[model samples]
Target: MATQTAAERREDARQRYNAYVATCPSRKLLDTLSDKWVSLALTALAGGPLRYSELARTIAGVSQKMLTQTLRTMERDGLVSRAVTPSVPVRVDYRLTPLGEDLMPLLEAIKRWAEIHMEDVEAAREAYDRCSDSEP
Candidate 1:
C-alpha cells in the first residue's frame, strides 16, 4: 500500500478550497448584485446608455443619493462605463461595460423568476405572517 505524502494532502486540500471559492460569490459581488438599487440601475441601463436624469426618472422611487452611490459603486466595479460629452452643459451618460453585459442574462433570468413566482412568494409571506401573529 502506498502512503500519501503531506505535500500531496496539502495539494488535495488546496484543490478543494479552490473549488469552493469558484462556486461562491464574493461578498462584494453579492452586495452589489443583491442591492435593490443595483438591480434597478442595471435593468435601466440595459435599455442602452442613459443620462443621469434619465436613469433617475426610469428607476422611479430611487433617491438621488442612492442612485448616485449605486452608480459610483458600479463604475468602480468596472460594470459600468460613464461618458461625458461636450454639450451646452456637460453631458454625462452611463452604459454597461462588457462585464455588465455579461451579467444581463443572469439578471434577466432572476427578473423572470421573480415575475413568475412573486405571487407564490407573497402567499408564503402572508401565511408566515398569519402563523406568527397567531403564535403569541
Candidate 2:
C-alpha cells in the first residue's frame, strides 16, 4: 500500500463530497448562492464596488435588515470584503474578493439564462396550471 500525497488526499476528499448528499457541506454554499438577495447582490456588484446604500437602492425590494445580514454572510464566506472609512458620517463599501470574482461568471450566466428564458418559463407555468385545473 502507498501513502497518498497531500494534494492527492485533498483531491480525493473533494471528490467524495457530493451536493446531492444531505450531509455534504457544499449544500450550504449552494443554499447561499441560490438566495435571491445573494444573486442580485452579486450581479449588482459585478459592475464595481458599491456602498451599502447603493446596493440597497440597486436591489429594489430588499429590506435594510436583509441586506445587512446578507452582506455579513457574504463577508464571512470570503465572497466579499467590506471596508469602513472613518469620517463625520463614515463611509462603507463592499467589493468582491478574488474567490467571488471567480464565481461571478457562473452567477452571471445563470442570471442571463433566467432573463432570456423567463417568458418560456411563464408559458410553461401557465400550461401546467391549465392542465392541473382541468384535471379535476
For residues 67-130, what per-residue lDDT tens digits would candidate 2 score against the true structure? 9999998999999999999996899999999999999999999999999999999999999999
The CA lDDT of each predicted structure is 0.90, 0.94
Task: Write out the backbone clash pairs for model 2.
Answer: none
Kindly list the per-residue Cα lDDT of model 1 for residues 12-69, writing each as its tens digit: 6776555237564354578689998999899889989999999999988999999999
RMSD of each: 6.6, 2.1
lDDT of 1: 0.90
Residue 23 CA error for candidate 2 (Å)?
Answer: 1.7
Q: Tell me the lDDT of model 1 at 102.
A: 95
Worst 10 residues of 2 by lDDT: 12-21
